[model samples]
Target chain A: MINNFHSLLTIMMTDPTNLLSLGWVDSFIIIVYFIFVLGIGYYLLRFTKTGEDFFMAGRKMTAWIAGLSFVAANLGSLELMGWAASAYQYGILATHWYWIGAIPAMLFLGIIMMPFYYISKTHSVPGYLKLRFGEGSSMLSAVSFGFMTVFMSGINMYSMAIVMKVVLGWDIHFSIWVSSITVMVYVVLGGLLSAIFNEVLQFMLIWLGALIIPIIGLIETGGWDGMVERISQNFPAGDYTHLWSTMGSFQDNPMGIHWTGIVFGLGLIISFAYWTTDFLVVQRVLSAKDLRSAKMAPIIGAGFKMMVPFIVILPGLLGLAVILPPLVGENQVSAMNPHSYNEVLPLMLARYAGPGLLGLGVTALIAGFMSGMAGNVSAFATVWTYDIYKPTHLKLSKKEESDAYYVKIGRWCTVLGVFVSIGTAYLVQQFASIMDYVQALFSFFVAPLFGTVILGMLWKRATAAGGFWGLFAGIGSSIGMWAWVKIYPGALKYIALSEHAKDMAENMYRALWSWLICVIVTVVVSYLTRPKADSELVGLVRGCTDIPSEGDLPLIKRPIFWASIVFAIFIVLNIIFW
Target chain B: MIENKGISIWFFIGSLLLIYGVAITIANVYEMISPSMEKQIVLRELNFGVWWGILLVIVGLIYFINFRPWKKGNNNKN
Candidate 1:
């Protein structure tokens, strides 16, 4: 049955026409999408009068709105294109980043961490650092995070340009300008509200657009069983089907990442850091209407997050099982091109989607790009205004400022942020893969930031000095590791299993080492430093903080109930896929 | 008034769905009426535009109705 589907795919591939090219109807659909997005921004502009409205949606978003936006902000071109490309390169092992890498951390955030964040009422993650660890730690966090967000926005811009250039044959520079301009106009005018609203809409469109490919592919290849059979037959050496079977040891996996790296490096450190701490994602949850909604947002996001692999990862597996054989033929060595693998999602869309749906799919891709850029830009603007600019520039000037003054500054910062992102996008051209670059950035910034935050929240003894130094040391160590690998590529052999393993699993080991260094530094420094008084630490540290009790809500509606359900499903998925 | 009523989010969502539906429907109909080889090929495969459009329009209408000031419920807080 799989062979029959393979033959059919081959016949389609033999056709002279490129499946990925955009037709008039498709372009029209994309145009309509843009117009609608701008229309929302214009309409919401009136409501965005106050800084709170612009920065945090006036703190009035329900669980559904905030939850959808929280997940959707993350469902950007990076998640769509980079992960699909990763799937093509690394097989089903890439799903680990989505499942074990995301679910538990999201649950931990909703159940354990949201109370601290929500009750504190801080505008950004760095704001929390300011309250807990004083000026030095907060400044370091704000500066690093400000720089990181702009860089991330630039990466999103670069990824969008690459996809457009490949799929629509658009000029890369032209694509970047159009997308950056579109994002800037809306974000500057309507602020985070516009971004979140578009994110919710994009979430719907993306599912509508991308879901069809895997469904059709599954039908063509005779379901999961057939896909597995076909993949093994075509490429027996490549372990593309199994997820955990390959994860027992570093040598056992196609990803060359051992269970320790997958569970500890990615699952604990990287995932926790991203979901709990990164303002790009956390900002949406922070905008929730109330405490209960805030707590429920990540839980809702986790439920949807666990299912994302089916849409994103399955296409790459299909590409491997069915599409790659015809294009590459039997001589896989000469046919190896990393660039071509990155085009898997676009190629699959071109193959499956016709005129109208084709438009929707392309529009969905653009939406993903725009939302990602907008999320980063908005987060940057907020952190800059409240955390950095407010304290440093505004305070020094000694001029009393109104809420509207900060809102104006937020708008200006949005413009500045997007411009910086455009510059960063050009810098990203030197990198081979966006995924590796993004992971490297996460290691440098997020790992240490999380270490500082976790210790501050759990251990009241963690002083201002410890927080600052621990974060500084963690970031410095990650940069050193990256430089060491670049200068002495053989350094990886000590940590990784083989030559291939060293290259593939470098980010995992770097994250592990950096996180270890951060924890050690923080613990030692905390013991030596003077701690904040118990009164000053109230509602900030875990033991001293009061956890909110569910009021009048039924058993099923409670956060604990939903978390259990999601975790049970998560465990079941791992077992089945194992 | 709309901001005070806290219906912007509802209206925004409704407008998005309605606009998407109308766009898809128009584009699909145009392809059907003045068909090119590309349009014919695309149409022949799986023209989900009209059906999905109609579904979205219905959903949009439901949301739009809920956005009416008279229909504002206890959860409507800005």
Candidate 2:
């Protein structure tokens, strides 16, 4: 499962037929792109100050910048490649995950969890937990956040490498190396600031390329009506038509994925944990200019989440229905056995996109992949340096060099993270549903952090002992059940284990179960322990409101941010007929 | 300090309405317009330099733009 997952990840990394296929124009275009990316990173480096600058982009991100960064982080190289693969493999049902899963989840997270965001204004989500619950809880969350990164970064990079090998005809190692080396160059140069700047560009660029293939495909096939007609004729409209159905012959079809699965099961749990609790989203909102900016960033993200179905999921199925028939046989469409649909979307892009614009599209995808890698590298470095390094080791009397050193080491850590994660990606390649594997592993850590942090802020009664024990209980049961589900496939296979099926241990990790168990353990532990001091809760609340007032918000952004989000939401509503 | 409450509230509402309106407009326009009409345009302009394509190219160019680390008057960084 892992090997197949890795192999299929790069299905869209490059075009197999275009091997050694460097045109003068393509070469020029590619060179220009490289110059711009490196240049942007270099320029953004100026924004780096003390450790905060390197780690949190100086906590000065505008809503526009945050929106772009969120979008970029939302997609990695694997996502750019995977959407095509998913669409081709599952028809339109791939989109349902975006609309049903991503859009509503992020929206609810923004509104429902605003109170939590208001209180825990720290660098990483674990840091917020620590602030809320005490040192022990924060430390626990930091460790879990670190673990989650290992799981997610590995899955993402590995999948991207798979696409490069399949699409670009590069050796798997070479793909991994090239991807790592290039992304590291900029990520190391500027840290999170560089990561965000580069990602904004990437988000726009990838979308440009991503949306292009479908429009062109639609043209080649006839149009939207043509697509629907072809889908109706060639495939069951039910499979291709619906966004929330369980279709696809590649893996186990778990029972927990029904309406209950979509809503109460995997959907509810992941949405609550990830949107409300996960530090990645939290980090972006925290970086906002103010409370208004913070709220705006997520609202915008929710809006874009809605468009993803149209932008990502529909194109792949359309590839299978409209474009893939003549160029590649069904055998080739299925690709090398176990039917690796991952590469088909990119392959279809190569097959369909006119040769003139092909280079730009390819370049855009490369940008998208690198941007995601950069986000992980930067994020991991931030947590390691801030939560682990500075807190643990040498203290500088002068804040300047200490800050400068953080800037320096933060960049170095990103480089280290890129290299380590690439290696980790290779290891993660053993799983099948690479995306699911990453998410499930994330869920294990995500929900516990959510539970601990929320309680830490709202309930002064939350205890450090409770925080530690709760984390252990939540994460421990997640991993344990994962092992059980993997070996047995017996009663609990219904879990899909949601994300675990995609990881190194294919078919465990059940996101919902992990969250439930984690919350239960955390609450029970908190209940068992002494209540937290009142002063600590007050401090956490004060910190949340303090920074946003003077530093970032200038009144101008307030309107722009709100406007952008409202627009984004409208886009969401129209796409899924929601 | 800069309490232009009226302006701030107006901008907030205006920005929200515009952004949301645009997002909804594009989506709605796409739906309202015949898919066949879109198909005709998309097919005719496979290689034609549409504004969308041009805009995409321009956006890519912006990513590559190089600025000196300490350019004379770039206050945005601070």
Candidate 3:
């Protein structure tokens, strides 16, 4: 593992020139970005007089900003490196999430889940759960989610720290500490508002700077047509030539079936969690000007998701055309070494993006890392505030002093979350592939609750017993499968899956199935056992709304009506064209 | 609490559909334009027209597949 890490370190820093050239202008842009983020966050801080203001942007985030922020938040440290690697490695197939995962999930969330979420407007998912399962359940959830925040923050730190080390020619530990502290300052000073504002800045930087990278990669191959031609020679199989199949090399086998599972399964489960549940994302919507605005956040984010192929994915594929030649010889070989996979992007940026563009890309890369780290810190703060702090103080008054104290606590939570995560980053398995691993880990917490929260809102009979059982069952099933994969050879070897596929399924499907089990248990157990009385239920029923409701107008009548039609059109199109 | 006076439901739906359509389209288009692997056939198992046709049919059928309408005035007034 140490040797593996060393090789990765080697590949990550293959280009000394890109490292050397990064200087004052790049530093200036990063500092400017820091100030810009801080300016907006602190400026926005004036509007935050109470806990709600600090936590949810006073629940008045505009639709476009909210939408863009969701994308920004979703686009974490991994894309700063991973997507670029994926592009060079897998071709268009590297980005299947935009279709099978993202598109469906967004529509599902907006149409199916968001309306309900907006109606049952709470500060956090656990707060939503608290309405359903009572206090104890919320606490358990807080613990699990808190774990996720730490784990995810660690991952963000780990990946960005690697990039920092690679690009800045610094030591890895130094890189990790520096990256963590840099992200911590602004996020700690502010909160989600700071995270959200920086996301907007970071995303635009990612776009204008990162998008041009593929062009340079393509240029090295002579142009798009030439790049396509070279890949065609290597990958001549059916659907292989098609737009989505991927321009992969058989000799190299960049990603196999497991890789496919990684793309698709995560889309179904963990990716859904990213889009729907995470506070960093949902909070973006939570801060919306209205429910209408909130609904649009993911939709707008999908726009960026769809376009990312040009910036992040294509470069990875183009790297097959450009960089892979030097590493693997003309015949291409297994991308077993994680660093080799990781280097796919950095090498392209070094070789192709010259001088001014290089500076911009470096700035954007830092901005992207900042956006990711900021989201993690702010999200960690959120869980700390709502679940751990505010709920325990029964006598906590709504006075100005009390509210300010809550906001202060929230900010400090951000600081603690960042520092702790930086320390933990060294241990995370997904250090090499941050987004996929971190998000899948998040699903372990988020999925079990999806069943619990939705049921609590709809089923008044959903007993605390059922909630506990459901949460327990979901976590148990997921963890059992995870352990089985790791310990039981018969389970894993006979499973005949790639490490990537198993990991992806462990993250996505295991949690989804667990959630399904928990949902069934919640309903059946609630029905079988004595139900909560009408008086005991804390939410609106029948025509009466306001069970943590956001008060946004419905996005469309019979939303599934359009959603199904959309699904049908694509299905038929795929059948006919192939 | 703000009043629910100004709203555009189709805009949201349209935006999501456009996002879905465009992103998936690129994946398909990129698949079409690029190669699969060295040892495999070059034609896509899932093509643009087929994918679109099936999608259109599903969208068409979704209008009819019949789901319970989320009732109006379902406010959260606890």
| Local distance difference test scores for all models | 0.79, 0.58, 0.59
Q: Candidates' DockQ values?
A: 0.30, 0.07, 0.02
Q: What value does DockQ give for candidate 3?
A: 0.02
lDDT accuracy of residue A350 in candidate 3: 60
lDDT of 1 by residue, A329-378 (tens): 12342535323677788777766666567778877788888888889999
Candidate 1: RMSD to truth: 5.9
Candidate 2 lDDT over residue span A392-480, tens digit each: 66444333345677777777777777767876776666655765666766666765565565555555666777777777777787777
Which candidate, 2 or 3, would have the higher lDDT against the true structure? 3
Q: Tell me the lDDT of model 3 at A304.
A: 57
- Output the chain A TM-score of model 2: 0.82
- Candidate 2 CAPRI-style tier: incorrect
Worst 10 residues of 1 chain A by lDDT: A326-335
Per residue, candidate 2 scores C-alpha lDDT tens digits across B29-75 of: 34334332321223433433233444533442332222222333322
Q: Candidate 1: which pairs clash?
A: none
Candidates 1 and 2: which is better by TM-score? 1
